[model samples]
Structures are given as structure tokens and as C-alpha cells.
Target: MPGKVVCRDEWLAARKELLDKEKAAVRAAAAFKEQLRNDFPMVKLDKAYTFEDPKGKYTLAGLFQGRKQLIVYHFMLGPDDEAGCSGCSFLTDNLPSSLTHLYAADTTFVLVSRAPVAKIEQYKKRMGWDFPWYSSFGTEFNWDFNVSLDKDVKSPVVYNYKEMEKPFKGELPGLSVFYKEGNDLFHTYSTYARGLDGLLVTNQLLDLTPLGRQDVPWKRHDEYDSKDLKAN
Candidate 1:
């Protein structure tokens, strides 16, 4: 059924009433959730995980690049993947412009993947992204972070804080936060699955429009057809 159409004055009156409730709910929910996130305990990293950057190799602490805070996006680009995950690429397409703001806030953002540095670089160049990306190939970083699943394992794999009965093989997307204090580094938080919805500005903007997200599978920004782009 179609929504009822109302006169301008009537629509304004109804919208204003709903806006008041929306504001109240947003304020209360945001405040409480922020507190919970801030209050979560941090875990000190003991193992020395190394990653391959464009220049050379770097330890996990080096990823911070002198910043007190670091945000790592676990991009789903396995060793055999010809291209990065479409959803991960979609999220990354919206990240380049935010680099300056994140730096100003004393935070460094980077993407980590299990693919080789050469493969990562090729895909990054193909996508025309300048954000820092590193390859965690031959390292336990992805496994320890719960982003990569082992196919040969006989038991259930733990992901998103629960044991998944049928775990996905290969790579999965996630976001992990780390805090650096002098020489010490701590894993502050990690979010997987829909928990990463907060980072998708495109979805947020679409939610404000009439058609919303349209429930279509996202493609890499460059892969979208001209007609499909116009329709959405």
C-alpha cells in the first residue's frame, strides 16, 4: 500500500512531532552506547605480529605511526582473491576523505589483509585508493583477530563473540581499535558483522532518502553500471 499524501501544513505538523521523538531517542541511545564502549576493558598485546607495508615490514605497534589511537579494517582479501571484497571496497571508497579528520583527531586508520603485499598493492591501485593498507600474509594476526577462518579445523570457530556452528571459510570483514601509551599497545575494541554499520556513510545518507538502501548487493564503486548507478 502507498503512503497517504498530506497537505504541506499538515505534513510539517506531523514531521515536527516525529522529529521531537527521534531527537530524544537518538540522544539517549547514543549517550548510553558511547559510555559502554568507552568503559570496555583493554587487552594488552603480547605477541609480535608483523605486517608487510609498501615500504617494508612493520610490527603491529608500528601501524600506529606515533598516533595514540589506531583503527584497522580487516579487509576480506584472501590470498587467492583476484579483487577485494565488494562490501569492504564499498566501505573503503568512503574512507579516503576522512583521513585528514582522523589524523587531526590523533588516530591512524589502515586496512589489513591476508593477501601478499603485491596483491594488495595491485588491488589498491586498481581501486585508486590512497589510504594505508598492509598485508598480514604468513602472520597469525588475522587468525588471532577472528577475521580469517581455518577450513581444516574440526571444531566450531568463534566469531562476533559466539561459536559459529558453520563458520565461513577464508576471510571476513571486521574493524579493530587499538590504543598506544608510550611503548605499550592495547586492543581496545573490535566489531564484526553489522556492528560496522556505523562506518558506512552511504547507508546513513540513504536512510534519509525515500528509496533508502534498496536492498541491493553492493559492488565496487567502479564496477557499478551507469544505469544501475542512476537508478539507485
Candidate 2:
């Protein structure tokens, strides 16, 4: 039935029931998110990590600049790649608007990626993003934040390519937080893998989709499903 369609009256009746279940599920998930926030308390950062500014200068305690709370997005830009991840690119786009409220709340937002400063800055300019992006390359920041796996011994294919016995396990995207208390900085919280979930406004809206996120592995324009790893 190429052009077959269900009877109009029957379709409407079925849709109504579907919508009711969808509504309940939405409320439940939102409630679950709220509960997780309270139950899983996040702490402040105690260990300091150095950062390379977009200008190619090195600085530590360098985040949030003059703000009280420091929020760093560990963008997933694999060292082998010449660019940052597209999902991170999307979050960067949102920052222009979020900056107003975030600044007002005394919260500072920035991106921390393993890519070299030169590379990170290049992408920033190309994307027309003015938000702060720093290079955490050759730094322990990534591993400390649990965003990068330990620089473990590489596999055979890696050795055949770069010929280095040991290489970074590569970087994953995440969000880290720190709070300033007088002169000392305390680690408040850190989100890794899919911990950056707050940036997904599309999936938030898609909860209302006819089939929902689980039904369709990928969103409209995206052909990949990185959400699964994060969800796990």
C-alpha cells in the first residue's frame, strides 16, 4: 500500500492515546533529571591545571577569567583530527546567547580541548564563535577531569601509522566545574562522556516526537549516534 493511509477517525483516536502516554513519560524523565541533580552531588576542583589561551599563551587558574564559578567544556577534538567535534560545535553556538545569563549569575563558561592552541583558535574563528576556547594539550587536565583516558599503550594499527608505542587514548567531551572560595578554588562537579547532556536541546524537544529518541537512533540531520555511549 504505497499511498495507503489509515482511516481519519481511527488515526485521531489512536494519536490521542499516544499523546497521553508521551506526556506522562516526559514528566517522569524531567522529574528523574531533577532527582539526579540532588542525589548525585558534584564537588569543586582542588587540583589546578594549566591552560593555553586562544592567543597561544599559557595560563592556569585561567578559566572563568574574573568570574566566581568556573565551567569548562572538555570538547572532544581527537588529536589526530584537524578539528573539534560537531556536537561541541553546536554547544559553542549556544554560548553566544547563554553568555548573558551565565555572566549575570557570576558563572564563566569556556571550552577545553586537547587540540593544540593554534588548531583550536583556527576552528573558533572559522565558526564565528567568540567564546573562550583553550588548548589542554600536553596537560593532565583532561585525564584529571576523566575526559581523557590514560595515555595508554597504543594498538598495532596506531603503531603502524605514527609508530609511537604509546599514544594518548584520545579525548572525550565533558563539562567540569570549580568554585572560588576566597583565595582557594574548590572542585564542585564534573560531567564526562554524556555528562554534557544539558547541551542537547534538540533531544529535549524530541521527547515529544512520535517515536521518540529510542525509536530513532539519530536526529534529523545527524547520521551518527554518539548519544548511546554517553547514555551508558
Best by the TM-score measure: 1
Error of 2 at 171 (Å): 1.3
lDDT of 1 by residue, 63-114 (tens): 9988999999999999999999999998887675758889999999999999
List the candidates' TM-scores in order: 0.93, 0.66
After superposition on all C-alphas, the RMSD of every candidate to the true structure, in Å, is 2.0, 8.5
**lDDT, candidate 2, 1-232, per-residue tens:** 2334689998899889989998998899899778755775655546656778746554456575777888888787756777677767665654555488888889888888888887877777777677777888877777666666645532332211233355546666677777776667767666654555567776666655555556443322233467544663
Candidate 2 Cα lDDT to native: 0.67
lDDT of 1: 0.90
TM-score, model 2 to reference: 0.66
Candidates in order have lDDT scores of 0.90, 0.67
Number of backbone collisions per candidate, in order?
Answer: 0, 9
For candidate 1, which ten residues in a row score worst on lDDT? Answer: 150-159
